[model samples]
Target chain A: MSHGRRQKPKNLLMILMLSPYLLLLFFFGVLPLIMAIFNVPTKSPSNPNGGWHVIKIVLHDFRLVPAAWHVLGFMALFVPLMIFFVVAMSLMLDTDTAPWKKWVRLAYIVPACISGSVAVLLWYVLLEPTLSPFKGVMHFFGITQASQIWKTSNLTYILVFMAFLSLAGQWILIQFGSLQSISGEILEAARVDGCTQFQLATKIKLPLIRKYVIYMGVLVFAGGLQIFVEPQLLNSSVYHGIAQQWSFDQLSYSLAFDNGNFGEASALSLMLLVPSLIGALLVIFKTDMFEDVNFKSPKKLAKEAKKREAAAA
Target chain B: MSIDFDKKAPATPEAPRKKKRKISIGHYAVNGWLIFWAIFSVIPMLWLILAPSKTDRQVSYKNPLSFASFHGYIRAWKNLQDFNSGVLAHWVINSVTYNLAIVVFASVTASLAGFVISASRIRFKKTFLISTLIMMLVPPVALVIPLFIEMNKVNLIDNPLSVILISSLYPFGAFLSYIYYSNTIPPEIYESARLDGCSDFGLYTKIAFPLSHPLLALLAFFAFVGNWGNYFMPYIMLPSPEHYTLPVGLGALFFSTPAINPGNGATSVPILKPEIALAGILVAVPVMIVFLISQKRLIRGMLAGSIKE
Candidate 1:
């Protein structure tokens, strides 16, 4: 009887705890995503018989698929840049006594705290030749002003930089944390064996943090593929671009709010669910990215490293 | 299996301290590069500070770094004031009210949720964590249209309730809470608490909440700043200028007034540019204060891995 009494309260508490989140998910996430997915049709009000035919028209159009491909192409450019950033951030983390660590860490993080739209606005201001302080610097390099990078075919790189600037910091933090988990004595042992700083960083530190690197790589890769606001805010005409709907998000907004194409908008947004669903799978089944820790005893490592240094002396 | 468990483990002595050496040229070079970037980081802040003093003409004609004219600032101030006969102050009030409400509700709820998920006897832990992670990854922009429609359906469109209620449900806050709860709240404490006849809620309020105060401060800072800096969500939801948050209100003030240039001319001197700059600086202050207060906590979290553990 007592066990039953206790179990009932536990069950009630669980339900009470879950109800709000469940309500939110149903109303906000699941419903919206569902509505977006079902709306892929390019509907015409003139045809009373046009119910499912619009979806067929959307499906038969090869053009829409290529637009998605183009967006994929745009996302591909980020791979090299992210590689460089992750490496630099990792190298900086490996430098234990480097005086610049504080400042470098600050640079790595400030962008994450700063607002994205403000970043868009800042870059917007920076690109304006007559208004920007950089104009004189640009002129000295024989570069003259034009209708900004976003206005041109070079829009891909602009989005790339925006992604790097805003998103790099948190990844840096994550990667740095991962790097810190590696015991310093390992680095010391390598140093005792006459390893240079560069070798210690790339060969030693990089290999140690490899899992975290992969984890962050996949996480950031997934996120970079979801780029919307920077591009949307930077160029208004991105709404009409080939990937216009493949942005999966801006398309949803433009479709629903601008054109009142609720079906197409919802369908486009439903596209976002694919990546998120994949991400969810990765989180659950594929990776232990969240659970495992490389955090060995820092004190032990420090003690060992100190003894090694003293022995070398 | 235990055959005489009296074996004493040997104590280890501290390692000898190595000689401190002279700093190297590489260190200086690194410091120089860092100093250079630190300046780069702070310049925008300096620009934001100085922008409010110039007029539209002077701003275009003079060194863009120079301050804006006083007359134009007053004019912008008056323009801002003229709304609802100074109900612009009410918009500021509303922003503070909404942001604070979000900060408190989000911080507490997320902390509770995070605590339970992290250090609970809960079923379906993996499912909950995955759900939270997926929610975090969905860019807020993608959800705006759907959210708008959803809010409209419920007749909360153009209502502050929409902004308040929607913004309160932050996934990142929950993530932070989970991380802090998992890492900072040691499992042993909970085990002890449960043995002491404490319920799960008692363990949380008595043990977890007190232990996680540092993290709560950190969460509060993030929640406050996130809500404060939000533009698009509030922009989409609130139709009237009376309900405008700082970013949206300032955005309207910026784009509509020709006298306030959106970086068109180097020396064009937009009249309200200085005031716009002032408003921008004002928006940043709360976050800055929060950051300063929680700098140690922020740095700790930053240095901690993806999950707080």
Candidate 2:
């Protein structure tokens, strides 16, 4: 049939457009993952353990527990604080009708320029009393030396501070963007019903944008879980061994490069990857994250068809 | 809801007056909060720019906020040039070349794949989309080792092509493009075009590509910024110092310099706080410039992805 003949070229064109991305994904994204599974560390001849014993080796490693604890502690501080502040600051920004709203948003994003390793450098300067602009504040806390601030126990707070400042601005802006999507008619209705600004924000806007906040939470959690660059750079450059294998990713890196054990490294990486994959799946299925795909559901199509037929009649 | 009623019952006509009084007080509080955080956000960037202008002695002893002269900056630049036979310049070139390649490849492939997935009756569409989503969420840090092994198998480990080809597989960009095309362009346009005998390639080149200027720009800008700031993958892949990107090179500079680790004792080179801060500023300059040029479009593009139509 002509229909069957026409489908061939259409399929060919689709394949043509898709092949480039699909090829890259296959080579880089999909293949490496498969390779990692196969490359999971096995028992050495000297150890004489079982075939799948590398998972046990990675799980029981001394550094593994501490590294996992470090990530959990970081997420504990980061995820909640990020959600609270981003939501609060964005809501406040949305409510303010001042002319300085544009400038405020711009200011929020300025710290983003000092991201990655530069943030680590900048925070060192800020934490070091000798070079910090907020020396008075440090002095008020009865601290006159860098040693007081960069203690081993304070690593969690320090990483959280660096991560928070570098990322909070962008999330605040994104949440503010989410706020803009709320229709004006709803806000106007709330106001006309004599709602205060606080009530309008909390009761209506917060409930409406709950999904966005959850989206932010999932990403922030995932990103925080993979805390590597800050701790790694700090450990290597600043105070040596101060943050050695302080994060899960850093531990995996040390295993592969320093320890020269690729099996244990891949095994540990797969372990770290499981939680993120679960989070991604939860976001995809549990939430309406991809509802904007514009592929109408059957019920929606049926309703639209009904409306069209009514118009024709 | 109770709070709404509590205020609603108190005043009908007088609500505006009461609300105005309350908002002014709350407004000042909000302004105070935002201003305080804004200062926290911007002070480091201001300090980074000014830190390069002061001497090593001044950096430790002088007022942290004060600026001295460009003499120190010029000296730092000269010292950076003198170090390792001027590898910093090579890093700048490598960063630019690698990022530009990624931008071109990511933009073209993502847009094309997105258009086809959304517009055409592609088989296994859900599989492609879900895989892309999973890939987007999979942190690159987790894959670096495996990718290193894969790249080593093909002997492309230290090659710039290794970084470009890997980094350009931006699943997030493809996802954004998929969402943008499907949400913005109605299927009717494609249908009409097909009715008029426009080929599928023609439909993309003449229709989708033309309509995707904003999405393409967004993809390019994000690709540049994201990979420009990337330190880990390139650090793992390109082991040679001369082949380093800006961040890895900066990391090397930090390692050699005694700027942060003052306890390492005196160094013969003049690579001190000023030099390190200068290098940091240099790393941020390109991203800042791009951001400044496309500030409005970038904000709009960000909103376009998250906004539910």
Pick by TM-score: which candidate is best? 2
Recovered native contacts, candidate 2: 0.55
Top candidate when judged by lDDT against the true structure: 2
- Give fnat for candidate 1: 0.16
The prediction achieving the highest DockQ against the true structure is 2
TM-score of each: 0.79, 0.93
Query: How well does candidate 1 score on lDDT at residue A68?
Result: 64
lDDT of 2 by residue, A45-99 (tens): 3125535688887889999999888889989999999999999999998884566
Off by over 4 Å in 1: A35-70, A98-100, A144-150, A169-174, A214-219, A234-248, A292-313, B1-31, B66-91, B184-197, B259-272, B292-296, B299-309
